[model samples]
Target: MRRGASRDKPGARVVQPPVVYVHGLGSASTVYHAHVAADPRLATRRQLFVDLPGHGISDRPSGFRYTLEDHADALAAALDAAGAVGADIAGHSMGGAVAIVLAARRPDLVSRLVLTEANLDPNPVPKAGSSGIASYNEDAFVRGGSFAAVLERVDPLWAATMRLADPLALHRTAVGLVRGTRPTMRHLLMSLPIDRTYLVGDVDNDLPGRAELAASGVRVEVVPNAGHNIMFDNPQAFINAVAGEAPRVTADAYKS
Candidate 1:
């Protein structure tokens, strides 16, 4: 499912640089197809949908570590393999954290960044730990088989991939996401020397730090009438947000 920009079209003018899209945990790159299709600019621009190690069609080697650093390194390697240098990056949820790390560690590989509801702080949230950093419950996945069972109903291919994914890799990656090492997402985002934007669904009430991010002058866009999964809930809004256009009011009671 790896696709790069088409260079064969004669006289084609590319206004924007290539973009690399990274999906969140438990999801594959296919999650972004709708948003890509909805936006004409993105459809024409060179785009790469990256599947993190053990998540999508990528190989799951025995000794590969799935830490945030490892994921960032893998993403960098993937971009290099595709000969994509200085490409814009967009990531959702856990993928956002990975994109932030990539921008911080390998600035040469990323030009601009668009992060949708990225986990800024991996600390525990309220509500019985049902969301935020606590949401990646490896115990529940292992004991209840919820990951496989739920995905089977929603996405059979993802379910099949989950069955083959290395449990240790999944567990370690989840743990690493919560207990991030030094130069955490916070530090990385604040220090990264590139243009970056933070986007979140307007209905996402559980976001860890909205006020602080706003106060810090980080550009934040709230898609109207959308939740955590902005792409699925409101594909047009997601596309508009990424394209730096004003959110289209598809619903009443638009929240700021």
Candidate 2:
């Protein structure tokens, strides 16, 4: 299992057979920290909350192309960096898309896979109002141009989204989204193959597949009372669905 920054923090315990969590677009690993922290069942599992390159404290190299494959490679590198050859994997939104790619490309590294609010459509679903733009873009464009111009464009939208997201995470996400460039995200989105078995928020504006995913042998669980940010709005529902579907092996393997 891989270790994360949480381990070195005060009162942190060693994560066994770690669980790597990939955050959604414009967000950092911290997005799932509280939700994961609240769950005792996942305590023993190490948490590798990736900040992805160019987000959070990680390096923001010039000419970085943010794509699904790039994000997956970042995850793979993170695992290798942590010496976690085998671990459980989970992601949200764009991160979810990346997680699916990672599992598909390197099945051996992933013991289990859980994706929340995964936008597998390969095309952006229209969202209304600021919450839509703020939730998705508006920040990345401005900041990604250059570090000096980054926050100049990021501040206003970041503040606005914070107000709408009663819980504060929406605001945090806005900031994270501003950190990366759109070309990278779009490139990654375009590169996605639209395949995998995972869960998506039933309330999510995008993804339109419950029947197809199930019929295709991909387990799809719908988290109710939640939108794209299921981990924040409906943690229990997300947890239950994940617990039910995300196991190291198939159901038959666990039955006996």
Candidate 3:
């Protein structure tokens, strides 16, 4: 943990084993703070809201590569330092991808997985979001006004956190997401012999390789009245999914 992990401010009584929450790109772990506080079953469990390097209150190291594996390794060290091994892990979008890599690369750190709108595809088109950020050279992004343009173009909700991230780190991480890891996060996720659950918005339920994921024994749940940002759009569903009381909508039902 070169820059150290960001955690919820201490004081709450720790009852059950700690659970880790990782945020997506251009966002901080604190995004889950309110949602966690709202859930009774999860409120008792210790919250390790980690702000991956280059995001939130964490430091931005110029030397860091900001790749998925790099983020996972750093997360592994942070979990070890916090003595939060074997914790249930939940991640959103880019964070979900990182969590998959973490569970695979360092299985000891994760017990179960709850992913929200994770991109299972190896390569995304280089037009917007991560790929858009990756489309430019670092120099053009970091020094040029490209970063500023991105901040201005995104919705205020995202820009609020994206503004905190280091341009260089953000660019590299996006590039890594586009380039993908050696084994690919999707492959690692499918092969993991753990209690895996993936939550996608009902409107966007047509997730890539969804049938394969279900066939691989992964629980694919749909969060109705929600979009990519599940926590924000429907906190109750997210909490239910995390608490293991998620809606029992069958695969056939979801598709129909």
Candidate 4:
């Protein structure tokens, strides 16, 4: 159940660079190809774009629960399937959150960690009756609705990168909006023990006390002129940053 391609050189594959990509809540891995292409270093590697358990081409079973561990487990399974253990990982949005949890849980499996427009703080619990963070809670907004109705009410929650992409991608991404269970989301939100470099977008103003979260010793960079989906808006800048960090993550990996 993955829906992405892998780019690798033919013949002996000893020099393979493995990078796994986890998409945001409402999108798939197609979002990073252009960014990867912009940087030649990222261009040559086995890039895995995985869909969460119940999203995209992956199975969507009834009563399926979506937790951070579940996403991490699914990612670990994918890496095992692809023989990409100890690979560098990058995640966006919800995927970014998942990446952090995975790295924290299994540091041995992760080399470099890159998170774009992701939250590193413990999941902020919204007020019981608060309409803050838009579609994040309200079942009316998170649940059933026409596309027009959805956009009118919840489009504000979208990242800047999503705004620039084709409307069809948005439509395709909406499939993730149907959260399986309240406890699942809650469990996932509570699993963050932050420590990493998380690149964020200023226009992504939905989160509460974001500055405070940034100050928690995590290297938080606000990508200029971007939104939650920064990769789509400023692909080159994002790619360069990832390319730059790749070496830092791999510098200690001596050849066997």
Candidate 5:
């Protein structure tokens, strides 16, 4: 389910497109949005939280694929249902990949993108979350204790929401993340004409093809004293990135 407050800010209601937060695998959008939404430094624009199907409080359809593309489509539908267009989007982890697909597939709904520690490559290492879950077959993952084990080991911050995810949805989503898209999220990201920024944590700072991304106009910024989960580690910095504060989008004379 989506939750948000309408724009009736101080003075007149200058209704700008809302800022939508999309969560990663086995997590809720509120995990990040809840922490930063009330920050005074944040945008006056309404903040919308999208809890993807099979995760958080949303219903899990047994037949759903829960793939990146599928998640992206769901996001688009959610935004459309909420009457939001050209929104500022901040997506983390698997949600970031989903966001990329959203922007590529439905460019009309996204104007600015801030991707935090997003998964750009396909079939990621089988050590971390997605690949780890993908390693298990659906039956083994859902019926077995693997889901419980994951909840036991994941970061406490994430575990809170991960525990709420449907085992089958989580497993299928993980498998889809590993399979990836035809052009790949990275390829689509580079070609996108919208404002794009990839926020990386200082700890996991080594992002492959950094130079190429910069050349292609994707600003790669770092949040200090944080890990893959920047929102949980340093939310202020994440808020800065989301509110378009830290990097400082300078206003200059038109180049065109």
Candidate 6:
């Protein structure tokens, strides 16, 4: 749990609430280590890294639905386990979406939010013969060998994790991601009472909606020379962005 600057030091500044880092699909808490370790601001603040249910070392309950809200609920429980009242949250991709839902559904558990390339639309692009999650072929994906290839290139550790993850849990979560719930990502981002920031990689061409988000008054930051996986491509830049030290840019350039 709690790690950062010692509170016993004389004249210690007021302690900032913990910052919880949530990883995206097929990713583990280790993805945030580089950025967290290098960020000086986090040295004095509590940092919590969550391994969402069905991913990493977390348990994979057979009855779980793995919906965005489900993931949020699990995260809320994790916070309770940590004895944290509320925390600043930084989430990437699927994790970002989960954070949005958490901030909307359980405002008491979130103080601030940092969403990096979170899915904003309820309907995701078609994949594997379906425009939504309804048609996802989990067994085929796992058995076809494509998932393995993708994981191997992205991160061998992730590949290993995938091999062990509950197939149903992973499939259901993926489906839930594509078929977002009633309070969609867009609504959650716009309505949450807490402070919200959106960060994207310069090369994340898939995120064409950042401009719209910026127009809505949300602060947006871009990590240069990076892609969808900002932390993996430019960990230092991600840390800088999270620390509010990264240079700001108008979202006009990212408009579709």
Q: All models: lDDT?
A: 0.66, 0.52, 0.82, 0.53, 0.81, 0.69
Q: Candidate 1 residues 47-104, lDDT tens each?
A: 7778788766666664666777888888888888777789878788778998888888
How many clashes show up per model?
A: 0, 6, 0, 3, 0, 3
Worst 10 residues of 1 by lDDT: 2-11
- Candidate with more favorable, higher lDDT: 1 or 4: 1
Top candidate, metric TM-score: 3
- What value does the lDDT take at residue 10 in candidate 5? 29
lDDT of 5 by residue, 1-256 (tens): 2221222122124566678888888888876667787777654668788888888888788888887888888888888877789988999988899999999999999999999989998988777699888988788889988888888888797788888888998899999999989799999999999989888888968677776777778877767899988987898888888888767322231121
Error of 3 at 133 (Å): 0.6
Evaluated against the true structure, the overall lDDT of model 6 is 0.69
lDDT of 4 by residue, 1-256 (tens): 3222333222234575476777776455654543464356666665666666544556544343355556676677677667777666778866776776677667666766667865444433342111133333334433444334544544453433333433333332332323322334323333344335556666753544444444443445557678766787767657865665522222122221
lDDT score at residue 73, model 3, on the 0-100 scale = 83
> Higher-TM-score candidate among 5 and 6?
5
Report how far off residue 50 is in candidate 6 (Å).
0.4
The numbered model that scores best in lDDT is 3
- Name the regions of candidate 2 deviating beyond 4 angstroms: 1-16, 128-140, 143-197, 204-206, 244-256
* Model 5 whole-model lDDT (C-alpha atoms): 0.81
Q: Rank the candidates by lDDT, best first.
A: 3, 5, 6, 1, 4, 2
lDDT head-to-head 3 vs 6, winner: 3
Q: How high is each candidate's TM-score?
A: 0.77, 0.64, 0.92, 0.64, 0.90, 0.81
Model 1 TM-score? 0.77
Clashing pairs in 4: 26-173, 160-228, 161-229
lDDT string for model 2 (87-205, tens) is 66667776676676676666666766667766554435334222344453434434443322333454453333222222222333333333433444333333434433465556743
